[model samples]
Target: MSLLLEREDATLEIVDDSVLTICGEADFDSAGPLAQAGRHWLAEQPAQTEVSFDLTGVQIASSAVLSVLLVWVRSVQRHSLRLNRVSLSPALQRLMDITELAPLLPAVETTCAEPARDRR
Candidate 1:
């Protein structure tokens, strides 16, 4: 399913290997789009497979970005998906660290060009 958020500078798209590339600003304004698109992706996972979010493209954001990722992590766990290590931006890592959600999302620092790996 294509759950891309349509905006002037932001987007949420299925790039490859079930990785959703969330680009641009993810502030309170974009939070709903992120959450809605994310839940759609999570619910559609047919098997226990990794789901990655390439957040390297995020230029600006707020805690809503973390909220979106946290919700996705919870949905994956609740659905018994084989998900882990959501590729995140360094900024996002720092935010998660601040919020104490870094452990739950199992975030990794990597670009979207790199293979989205499900490192245990």
Candidate 2:
């Protein structure tokens, strides 16, 4: 799994105050890097940091990965930071819907109007 955490499109222009944008895959194997990058950014910022997770590139994710993401979200909430603009895959969206995690994941937005076909 490829996980890249960097400035979007090399623009180098900060979109929001204390906001860190993450774009890449979030899965069991890639969750470590994603979590690490998020933690590092949070540590660098003072307070009320906003982390936007762009999941447009993410193709697959497991329950473990979802748990990891939830942990990060909780940490951000505890620190009073804002987690916004979270994009999710259709499969993940369904999982969140089924598990009633949509309320917890307020930052995540549904990109797919229809439910994804479950391969599992």
What TM-score, to 2 decimals, does candidate 2 have?
A: 0.62
**Candidate 2, residues 1-120: lDDT per residue as tens digits?**
222254322111123444333333455665666666666555565566666644434455467556756766776777777666665667666776777776776573535332133211
Clashing pairs in 2: none
> lDDT per residue, candidate 1, 10-120, as tens digits?
778786657877877878888887878877778888767777777777766479888887787777877777664466677776676677766566444333243244221
How does model 2 fare in lDDT?
0.53
TM-score of each: 0.79, 0.62
- The lDDT for every candidate, in the order shown, is 0.70, 0.53
> When superposed on Cα atoms, how far off is each prediction in RMSD?
5.5, 7.4
Q: Supply the global lDDT for candidate 1.
A: 0.70
**Residue 102 miss distance in model 1 (angstroms):** 1.0
lDDT over C-alpha atoms for residue 20 of model 1: 72
